[model samples]
Target: MNDGPNDTTDLFFRDATDLAHLIRTGQTTSAQVVQAHLDRIAALDPAINAIVTLNEHALDEARAADAALRRARATGGGPGPEIGPLHGVPFTVKDSIDTAGVLTQRGSPIFAGRTPQTDATAVARMKAAGAILLAKTNLPEFSYSTESDNLLSGRTNNPWNLERTPGGSSGGESAAIAAGMSPIGLGTDLAISVRGPAAQTGIVALKPTHGRVPMTGVWPRVPRRDWHVGPMARTVRDLALAYSILEGPDGSDGFATTPRGVDTGVGPAPQRRLRVGWFTDSGLGPVDPQVARTVQRAAEALRGAGVDVEEVTIPALQENNPLALFNAQHVMELKPAMAEATAGHEDEMFTMSTTMLSIPDTSMADYLAAEQGFERIRDGYAEFFSRFDALLLPVLPTFAHEHGAGELTIDGQVVDATHVQTFTVQFNITGMPALSMRFGTSTDGLPIGVQVAGPWHAESTVLHVASVLESLSPVKDQHPDL
Candidate 1:
């Protein structure tokens, strides 16, 4: 694994939308676009262990997109124009999400032979937007762990440090983007599956407000109150673009509601100085000294950028009980789905221990009670947001943990490798929009991210603050050495 600064210019690392623009302008053909990404995936994916299945039909679609783009140009862009907003752009989907005709094991062995006959709502949206699905990336079993390690596809290594995790369930998507295997892809965040991986990989990811993106056809066929599918990309702007395409009620998924796209444009910038809350040293047990410093530096930089940065303590929110309850309820929702995904493969390596199931099962009644408690917590945040426009906090307690290692321990505390997702789950519970923007690196050189969260349905404010941080810190162009 080549670890220092990455300079894979021979590889295609530009934003997917930019590549689509090139195709639309005739600067590049879709066939060429597809080959470029496929070649890169073939060459670099081996190192990160991020890709599990490649779309064999990718080139055929690419050729069609090329023909369509040329025909559009010849007719002055007539007859339906290009098929999708991302027409011909190569992309990936987390293995947990279904792509028609593709294998979607959900990182478990029991469903090793499983295949879907229909595209997931998010995948269908991308296809309708003109995206050419390239491959399906790896993830933890049923996306239950914060670290990606499954019996079928092994583990996804962090690009920054191959020995460290990319961040779970969505690690493959995050690693693939970090290594430029694919420019942009979809990730589902129930806990921090999206944000955690993005934070560890130095990429931009968002878990849109609940019901913003349709979750139909997502495997495990479960309805998660804390999960939403969103975009993962190297640039925040690219994430915004993809989010615009994927947002809206698909009419099929009962959980999805809003169909509003990015027409709201970029929300108003903070007119008066914005009051930002920062939590560096939350007494959340042996907080990584490096993570604390990284977050502090980021907060200080935002303050320097003319924002009112307050060192406020969200103690009640910071405590894990409410978050734990929320996660337990989510686990309850997944039990049946888990049974389906793991059927007949219970004896597979890395299979869940009886103890793992017992925790959520035992907490069943408490899980329901926790659901009620979570509402109160969400209300508390609502009240807090009434005073402040956004809240800033660490995306993870520490930098990327060592890749391929089983179980994650921090500060002598054993956290469910999956449950450490506490940092990102709260915003999901409140149905608020949160952006995991790259801030800086840890002392050990792993990426550390800060969450920019806003009130429910206030995606504009969340993104506005994210854009400001993007401009202030300016970590967008940096890529990993594959």
Candidate 2:
């Protein structure tokens, strides 16, 4: 908390959309906006370790944006050049996503000095929308774990409580946004990477349907089918804005096919009488009572808002655990690539990556069986969505946990750290869209979040429901006391 004399210091806490409006209306200069966030990062990031690399030319980019805005103003209301919706706003990216000339070490020493010549599709799209890249955030090695610790960048601590993790592999991105270091950032989700971290840090994140956004330039590119690139922001509207810009095929990633009949923007009118399902546990593991209560409260809020909210159990979802399917697929597909990437530098690899490589091989028959089982899970979700607009569930079994903890206790029952993804992995397996948002605070003062999930290509529905819940959430405006 460096309380600067400049009035623009408070602007760092505003959402991306509002920041862009301030710049557009001449209320604030892009240079000032960028400087505000840069100053905040300088003051707050030391303890959090969220931002791993700062862009040296960020101020220069802000100056360029300011000049462009001045040029547009000189036109006297006549359009000269198209200004992006996010003009002059600053953003960050996960370390694994490529940024031209910026280090993308993927949280591993194996790629310690690696830098890309071209930006990832998502990065280029954000920049083209007038977002200045301020810095790169931290993640687990190759983004293999649910925590954000790594040998290259050490660990990213939760902004709410320094002793806890921010959740990963998008942990750094969420931590940065939570601490007001950046307004919004890009993160990749495979399993619970994006949504999990967002839940832990009290921010907003969207895991768009698989293929809704391009996945080009992401490292350790295994689990290709489940990998997703989405935006993490402080507001759902900002997430929608970024999603609109980042969606669609970029002609690079084969999986980035154009979505048919999908509405990327949030409409002005509120949805009416939507059907939603609420559940405390996905049956994969035990959930903290406080977390479960938060989900129930969200459902009741929606019910009060005129939405048809009901507590229903999808037996198909509860009967089988899909975590093993993901693990099997990941190990089968990524083992060869990991071996190649770290060929002679095995000692530099992190424990997670090395351990994943050591997993016993799965036969082709086993891989096929797992894929078939995954299809059944997808079908189950499709059937469930046909009856409801969205499902509300816990983002994690518990709130943020202590760093390096081998196991977590939920309701006096000890569970392995691997079960942290229990509630989130199903969506990845089903290729459905899911959004994580802050719903309430824990008894220990940590944030609790709930997941809003929808069928394939139904991101708009998911976001709409999240926006509704956000309006009724008591912790909507709450931020870490950092």
Candidate 3:
């Protein structure tokens, strides 16, 4: 680790809310804040390969924020303490998301020269909250893979260890946030995109209920069956704050029927009595012994608290897993978009798309059946949550796997890498909220995370539980040694 004179890595490690507080208090100018993060990115990004695109215009935005602050200060009436809730906080998002005039290539050569004419709803929301867009992070092609890699941007390596992956498709965003390149970021989770990466990078991420946030300009996976726009940050509060800004219904998403009646700015407060269900294995995949142990420990901690904790099984998960169906739907829906994005580069697109579609296909009838299956699962979750306030599970079967490795081996058993996404994807399918927070580190120093599943539109419950766990372990402000 390069420790320079006046190193700002420590400063950069602050959560987004804390950073915003500093900016609002005039303790740190936005330009200085941007420069500090930029410096950290320059020094550490080489190893993590997290932030693929550095926004050269970020400093300009920072300067504008500073000028705006000065203007507000110059007024005879001093600037109101409440400007934007984000008030000059710096953040990033997956490259797959539209970032105004920036290249939103969806991590493929197909959109090599493509630039979004407008910002994605989440990006616009974040910016409106006074968050500065620092840069666009990398992802898997079309945000398809569980690992971040594309012909346009090589691969995003895990911050905990360079050779391993920072889970994807939001891998870059997680890696960047983990290494302190950016304090917080918005990451879409169709499957394990957000939680997987958060688990690997030791960050806190939330996949709010489906439609909790609009997916206006996000790259689609054909059919777009299970997907979500969520917040990935170094702390649970940061994730909650980011989610508050990003949540809402937009006129754009076709599948978004109605905006769940949840207030983004001020959500429902935490309840007095809490019931939590803890399960390390759901009979889906083999978990790393250490990951399981750490999660169980966290569950025990929660039980020790006033909250009620138990091991309850959701039977629907056993017979009707939507893993295959979800992937099939994603590939089918996005194939055309991917093809169009890679028009000039058909070969690359074909290769990537084929790699994605090669997974077992769930036919139209199969999809219809899967839809019914998902409804059952959703109902099961509803019933489960009626009894339990939250459910706990491992974010991934193991810590960060080797970058772009095809499969994951757990305790002498080889599980398909694609299966690692199974746990997180079900939440998207059920339109429920799920949170991933760093539980502990593996013997190799790689981070392991635990996921908290809450009922539909219950982001507050999920966040409250995560905050409790966060208070117990306190994973925030601990950036990688990068």
Give lDDT tens digits, candidate 1, residues 1-482.
11221233433777887777767666667787788788888788888889999999999999988888777767875435445679889899999898899998888776788899999989998899889999999988877777888878888888888888898769999999998888999998876879989999999898888888888877555646667898999887788888888888888877777657532323656448787887854544445666777678878888988888888766556544555676567666776666665566567736443335555463657776877778777777867877787888888877788754455677677765554566777777777788887888776777878888877777777777787788877465777766
Candidate 3 lDDT over 256-348, as tens digits, reads 665645632113354356878988776666888998898899989898877788886788787677686566555556656655655656677
lDDT of 1: 0.78
Residue-by-residue lDDT tens digits, candidate 2, 172-223: 9999999999999999998999999999999999999888888998876777
Candidate 1 versus the native: TM-score? 0.90
TM-scores of the candidates are 0.90, 0.96, 0.93
Weakest 10 consecutive residues of candidate 1 by summed lDDT: 1-10
Model 3: how far is 399 from its true place, Å?
Answer: 1.0
Stretches of candidate 3 exceeding 4 Å from the true structure: 1-9, 256-272, 328-331, 336-344, 357-361, 474-476
* Candidate 2 colliding pairs, count: 0
> Which candidate number would show the highest lDDT if scored against the true structure?
2
Error of 2 at 337 (Å): 1.1
Per-residue error at 273 for model 2, in Å?
A: 1.7
Q: Model 2 residue 375 lDDT?
A: 81
lDDT on C-alpha atoms for all candidate structures: 0.78, 0.88, 0.80
C-alpha lDDT of residue 92 in model 2: 98
